[model samples]
Target chain A: MEALLEVRELSLRFGGITALSQIGLAVAEGETLAVIGPNGSGKTSLFNCITSIYRPTSGAISFRGEPLTRHSPDEVTRLGIARTFQNLRLFHNMSVLDNLMVGRHLHFRKNLLAAVLRLRGEETRHRRRCEEIVEFLNLEPVRKTRAGDCPYGVQKRVELGRALATEPRLLLLDEPVSGLTQEEKEEFAYWIHEIRGRFGITILLVEHDLRVASRLAGRMVALDHGVKIAEGTPAAVQRHPDVIKAYLGE
Target chain B: MDLVESYAEDLRFARRPAARVLLGLLLAALAVFPWVAAEHLVFLATLIALYSIGVIGQNLLIGYTGQISFGQAGFLAIGAFAFGHLRIWGAPFALALLGAGALAAVAGVFVGFPSLRLKGPYLSIATLGFGVAVYQVFVNWEVLSGGRSGLAIASLQPMFGLSGTRWTYYVYVLLLTGFTLAAYNIVSSFIGRAFVAIRDSDIAAEVNGVSLTRYKLLAFAISSFYTGVHGALYAQILGHIEPQIFNVLESITLFVAVIIGGVASIEGSILGAVFVTLVPKVFANFREMVPVVYGVTILLVLIFEPLGLFGRWLKTRLYFQLWPFR
Candidate 1:
């Protein structure tokens, strides 16, 4: 399969602290790639570099063979990348349905005049797509609920739904199932695998929970102290000595 | 599709057909009001209508997009001066207002560019300086005022030779109606959702593919354009203009009305504007205490109802829905 995203020797630093150092990874089209690391192990830093939230201190990231060096976050998103935050960065004051509509903002074409005329055709098309995502996520019950007020699990679901609404080819999920129940984790793992096939998306996820990460990602990259310590099948990575030392507090 | 789920969805928005009909009747009453009311009352209502449009525009910026501005009066001044010049040159009224709106929108974008990096008190101070700078320019520039003495606005010609306050009165009322609907459509549509999204979390908004620069400037431009429209109407109704019309205090009055009515609610802003305008007249006897009274009213509203009158209205609506049992 063609490489959809390639991070070559990515290094991100904040003054003296190294967030990610000489990190490298590749996600193929329609593959699940998980970055598993302990707290402060630079898992999120990797995601941020790819999304262009933080320009890497050194090295390069390319999407579809084009250098993503100069792109801003929103520009990166428009290039068909979507992501969800680990702590759930949702529009707190807006209704649940409105959040989904926000995700479809890129696809809206009307401006001041057409909107003032109550033009329904353009708006209705986007609304129909948003409603489909709502229904799929089983969020119909809290469709009107303010995202801030939704239960944590539901917020995570909405965040995912929101990213999905962007119609992205690459989905970056940062700890998508951390706070989810056991059943939810299993359900979410199913969706993770299913989404790769269903949407033909390349997913790069960061999760600390080994069981969930190993279950969801076919291959895993383990990091320790800003360095990629191990990479291979999830089973093999889990048994690596450095991976054990990183998670076991050695 | 089940009971609880559907009910919650329905309650999320636009829950009242009967109440909407009642609102339509109230608007019809407003339509015919100019004919029956005394001439003085028509003038007062027209002032209220103009300010209603101004405050509605103000509400969209601070209330919806969560950007604070103390400089809308600058846009109003720019529009009024531009309209005053156009009117003096014998340009038609509608075209002149459009020109005024476009000019003010240009200024809005110009000023709103650096303002994108500002928020909270920093944004407020930047806009406050803008208002002051515009005010000084109007006062000092002989060209802007047609001289320090100010310019005279042309009287609006009667339509179809229909002579009366009723003709112009209907025009103002109809424009206000159009403006109110436009505001409604904006808040309920994709454009408004983008505003709210940027307001709530700009980082998340960018990640979700909203261009902050585009929406922020659009908000400023749209907000200023409407304020300019209000300024044009103000010039026509008053028939004279000076820099004094767009002072910092004038900006405050509109801003206060928006807060007192309800921060983000359209009806709240309009109601607040009318209430603030008329209440001062009732206490015209104690004219010295008007500002004092105004300050106290706003403080009281903030203390008792931070959401302004709209919060109480929404609560009352819920209360009535669950009446008798609750």
Candidate 2:
């Protein structure tokens, strides 16, 4: 399988504290790869580097064989990479549906003249696309409610819906089920599973829950202290000696 | 209940039929107001219309874009001075107005640079310094602004067989209506959503593909253009442009209008403008007490209705819409 996203020798440091060092990973097209690690294992740091929020001290990230280092966060999204945060970052003041619409920002016709003229054809078409995402995520009940007011589970789904709205080729989910209830987790896992098959999307997720991670991802990469400890099938990675010591200690 | 069956219906200016009727009646009243009212009242109405444009501009930066600016007076001064210069150089009224707005927009972009590094009170102070600097320039730059004595603007040329105050009133009101529609269109479009997204979470917005630098500067330019146009009209109305007129107090007043009207609301900008304009007239007998009255009114509104006058109006409408339920 061709790599949809390729990371090589990526290193991130805050002064002397290294967040990620010599971290290398590749996500193949249409595959769901989970990065499982303990707290502060440089999972989010890797995502930030890929999105260009933080400049990696060393190494390179490329999507479809094109270099992604030094591109701005919005530029990354323009290149068909979308991500959700560990903590939900919904536009609290805006409506739930509007949150999804914002994900479609890059896709919208951005002519200021057209905007000032209040042209509706293109806007209506894009809005219909967002509506489809809303239906898929089962967010129709709170579609008009403020994103800040939605329950945690709903907000998570809204974030997912928002990422999906971007129509990204590579979706990065950071702790998508961290605070979700058991039922919500199951629902989220199902959605994550369906997303790959339904949209032919490639996913790279960071999960702390091994059960959820092992269930949703066919392939797994384990990280510890900013280094990749193991990478293989979920069953093999979970049983690796390095991953066991990183999570359970000596 | 009114149902929006189509996406087009959902995006309509007045979603409900009742709102459309109310909007029609309000517009009709506005069209006839100058003819039916006294001369002084017409002048006040015109002032409100012009000031509303400035207030709307302030709201766009502070409310929608979540950027604070206390230098709107500086932009206004740029506009007023630019218009004065353009008119003196034989530019037509529309051309002069647009030139004034463009000049102010250029200044707005300059001010926006500091915002990339500063936020909240720090940004406000930087803008306040800008307002002071502009005032000082007008005071010292004799050739440009005629110095401390002030610059005299010529009266408006007759158009459509209408001249003097009535013509000015009609022109200002028409421009106000056009600008309000434009503002509405902007706030509902993708650009507006990008602005709101940045305000809510710039990180999320960037991840979702909104460039902060581009949108922030655009907000400043657009907002400044609105105020700059207002300042051009104001120069005509006052017939004299002075450094003292575009002071820190005026900047504060514009900021107050955004808050007292409601942040991120079009109707709130107009409401705030009306309140700010009418207070002095309402206290005409006690001219010295006008500022005191403004202070009291703002305090009361902030405490009782944090969302501002427009929020209160929304609540009232909702009450009636769901009558007997609560």
Local accuracy of candidate 1 as per-residue lDDT tens digits, A61-115: 9999989979888899999999999988999988898899899988888577877
Query: What does DockQ give for each predicted structure?
Result: 0.55, 0.86
Each prediction's fraction of true contacts recovered: 0.78, 0.89
Query: For candidate 1, lDDT tens digit of each residue in B269-310?
Result: 888879778977899899878778779988999999999988
> Candidate 1 falls in which docking quality class?
medium
TM-score of each: 0.94, 0.97
Off by over 4 Å in 2: B158-163, B284-292
**Local accuracy of candidate 2 as per-residue lDDT tens digits, A97-212:** 89999998999878999899898777899899999998899998999999999999999999999999999999999999999899999999999999999999999999988899
Superposed Cα deviation of residue B234, candidate 1 (Å): 1.4
Query: What residue pairs clash in candidate 1, if any at all?
Result: none
